[model samples]
Target: MPLPEFNLYPDFNTVRLSHAYLNVSDLAASKAFYCDTLGLQITDESETHVYLRAMEERGHHCLVLQKSDAPGTVDAVGFKTYDEADLDRAEAWFQAQGRPTQWVIRPYQGRTLLTSDNLGIPLEFYHKMDRLPSIHQKYALYNGVKPLRIDHFNCFSPDVDASVAFYNSMGFRVTEYTEDEDSKRLWAAWMHRKGGVHDMAFTNGTGPRLHHVAFWVPTPLNIIDLLDLMATTGYVDNIERGPGRHGISNAFFLYVLDPDGHRIEIYCSDYQTVDPDLEPIKWDLTDPQRQTLWGAPAPKSWFEHGTRFTDAETRDSDIAASPIIAP
Candidate 1:
C-alpha cells in the first residue's frame, strides 16, 4: 500500500515531549531518584505506578514509573499533541500502517494512543492533557524560572535499516544519520516527527530496546544546577556523562541513570527544524566527528545503556529473533 499522507497526521503545530515510562523493579527507589534527586514532584501514585511532574507543571505527571517484575526495562515514551484533531489524525496514520494500537482515556490523561514502534518500545500519543500552571508564576521564590518539559527519547533496534524504514514510512524525517559504508550497516539515525524528536530512534543493536529519555531545561545553567543537586542529594555517582555539547543537535547534554538504571538526559539549545523542507544529515559511523565534533568515541556505556523492545511490539519479525551483543 502507498504510504499515507504524513501532513494529515494531525499537523501538530508544536509538540511538547510529555513523559517517559519506566518498568522499575523497585518502585520506592525510582520514586526517590526522580523526586529527591531530580526534584520532580509526585502528582499521583498507586500500588503499581507513580506519576511525577516537574515543579513547573501541574500536569498529572511527566514521568510514570510502573512497577514491573523486571527492572531496567523502558515501557514507553509519551508525547502531547495540540488537540483531539491531532490525536484522531495520528490514529488514522497508524491505522493505515496496518499496526495494532490500544486507545485509552484515563482519569488523568485524555484520549491517548498506545502503539508499538519498530524498535519494540510502546509509544503513546495524546491531546487535551492538562497541567497546572508553573509554580514559578505563583511565587517570587521561583521567579522567572520554570522547568521545560521532555525533549526526546533514544531507542534501540537490532537492525537500524529496518527501524529507519519504519519511521520514515510513518513520516518521521531524518535529522541526522551515522553509517558505515564498508560494513554496509546503518548504525544510527535521528528522526523527527511533529516537530522536535519525541518518538523512535534506531541504534545499532541486537534487537528493540530503549536508550534514554531526555528532558529539556530552559537554560544551560539548569544542567549545572542539576549536577550540583545530584552531588548534594548523594546521587553523584549517577552522573553518567558530562555537561558537554552533542554534535548531532548541537545541544548541551548531561546523562544520568535513574535508581533503576534507566537513563535520563538533561539538555538545552537544540535548533528547530520546523521549515517545510529540512534535509536529513548523514554522518559516517567511522567518522570520529559523528560522536563528537572534536573528541573521542562515546564510551562503551553510552552505547550499551539503552533498552530494547520486545519482538511482538516492533512489528518487524526479523528483529524479534536477533541476538544482541553483550557489553
Candidate 2:
C-alpha cells in the first residue's frame, strides 16, 4: 500500500505542533525539573496531571505531565490548526485514510481530534483552545527572558529512514540528516512542519521512544536566564548537555530531564525555513563534529534511554526498524 499522505482537509487548514504530555513516576521530582530547572510555570494541576506553560505564552498549558504507577511513556502530543475550518479538514483527511480518531472536548482547549501515528505515538489535533483568563494579569511581571512556547519534539525509532518517510509523507520536511557507512541506514534527521524545523524528528535508536521536547526561546539571552535559573534552583545536575551550538539548526541548546528520565530541551535562535525551495541537508555519520562542534560526548543514557508512547494500531502493516544502534 502507498504511504498515508498528510492531508489537512478543508477544516484542518493549518496545523501546528504544540504541547507534549509525559507520564512521570515522581510528581515532585518531575515538577522540579520543569518548573525549577527549566523555568516552566505550573499553570494548574489536579491529582493526575500537571499543566505547564512558558512564561510568554498565555495558552492554558504547553507541557502536561501526569503521575502514573506503571512504566512511563508519552501520553499525548497536542497540535493546533489555524482555525475551525482546518480542524474540520483535518478530521476529514484522517477519516478518509481510515484512521481511528475521536473528537474530544477539553476545558481550556476547544474541539480536538485524537489519533495515532505510524510510529505508534498518540497524537492530537485542535483548532480552538481556551486560554487562562488570569495569564494577562499574572504573567505581566515576567520581565525575565522568556520563550514563546513549546516548539517541537524529537523521537528515537528503530528505523530512521522509515520514520523519516512516515513524517515526510505527512507533510514534514527533512531539514537535516546524518547517514552511516551502510547505505541502508540513517542515523538522525531533523524534520519540520508548519514552518520551523522539526515538529518532530526521528533518530536511529534501539526502540521507538521520545528523545526530548524542545521549546523556542525568544532570544539567546533567555537561554542564559534559563541556565542561571537552573543553577540557582539547584537543578544544575539535571543539565544533560549544551549551553552550546548545534551544526544542524544553528540553534543554541540546553537539555534537561524530568523526574522519570524524559528529556526536555531549551532552545533559541534556530534558522528559519519558511521558503518552499530549501534543500534538505545530509551529514556523514563519520563526521567528527556530528556529536558536537565543541563539548563532551553525550552520555550513554542520552543515546540509549528515551520514553516511548502507544498508538491505536493505526497501521495496516508493521515495519521493523532500529531507532538507536550501538555505536
Candidate 3:
C-alpha cells in the first residue's frame, strides 16, 4: 500500500512516548515487579495507584499502576507535547477528525487531552508533567535491571496500513516497516517523534491491544542481567522471550510478563533517526531475521497475545478486533 499523504495531517508538535498507565490486579505485586525487580523508583503511591520513574528520568513518572479488578489491561498510552498549546491543538485535531475527546486533569500532570486513535486505542496527550530529581548517578539506589527510561510502545492493530496512515497524519515519521511477501500489504510499522527507531510501533494483529511497553537499559549486558535476576527470583516463568537483537531497529531486547501478564520489554542499542531526508527501512514479513537478527522465531504468545485497553471516558474495556496475521 502507498504511504499516507503527510501534508494532509496537522503537526501537533509531539515530543515522545512519555508514559503509560496500566491496570494491575495487585498494586503491591506490581510494585515489587517494577520497583524492586526492574529498579524503577517510586515517585508517589496510594492504595489505588502508584507512580514510577526510571533512574535517569526527571519526569514525575514514566509508568503508572492503577489498581483494578481486570489484570493485563492498559488505561491509556500517553504522549508528551512540545507545549501547552500543543495540548489544545491535539484536542482540536482529534475533534476535527470526528473522534470523541475529553479534557482530563491527572495527578502530577498538566491539562491532558484524552482521545482514541483511528483504531480506537486509548491515548493521552499532555504538555507538562511534575518534575522529579534524577537518580542517574546514584548507584546506591540501583537494583535489579535498572532501566534508564521508557523507550517505546508496541500496539496491535487489525489494520496496519490504516494505523500507519493515522500516525503519519499525526506527524509521526516511519523509520521501519514490514510488508507481506506475496501481497506486499503492510504488516507492521515503526514510527517516531523523538528521533529514534520508534516511539510507537503498530503490528498487524487483533486490534487495539498493547503488545508491550519498552524501557531502555544501558547496555546488552543489562538485558542478560535482567534475565538472571528473573531466573534467580523465582519469576523465571515470566521471562517470555529474548535476549536477542532485532534486525529492524538493531535493538537488543528481552520481553517479560509482569505479575498480571502485562508485557514489558527491556531494550537497548537502537540507532538515532534524526535525519530529515532518511528513507524508512523496509522488510519482508517472511524474513526470519526481521523479527530476530539471529533467526530465532518469536513464540506464538508473543505474536498472538496483548493487553486490552480501557475506554478513557467509560472506563470499560474497549472492543477488540479479530486477529489478521498474514498467511
* TM agreement with the true structure for every prediction: 0.81, 0.82, 0.94
- For model 1, what is the error of residue 187's alpha carbon versus the real structure, in angstroms, after optimal superposition? 1.9
* Better structure of 1 and 3 per TM-score: 3
Local distance difference test, per candidate? 0.67, 0.70, 0.86
Shift in Å, residue 73, candidate 3: 0.8
Give the clash count for model 2. Answer: 25
Off by over 4 Å in 3: 5-9, 312-327
The 10-residue segment with the lowest total lDDT in model 1: 317-326
Residue 75 shift from truth in candidate 3, angstroms? 0.8
Q: Is candidate 2 or candidate 3 better by lDDT?
A: 3
User: Tens digit of lDDT per residue, candidate 2, span 51-135?
Assistant: 8887667678888888887546787788877777766776776777566688876657888888766666777888766676555
Residue 165 lDDT, candidate 3, scale 0-100: 83
| Number of colliding residue pairs in model 3 | 0
Candidate structures ordered by lDDT, highest first: 3, 2, 1
- Residue 304's lDDT within candidate 2 is 66
Query: CA shift at 21, candidate 2, in angstroms?
Result: 1.4
lDDT of 3: 0.86
Q: How close is candidate 1 to the true structure, as a TM-score?
A: 0.81
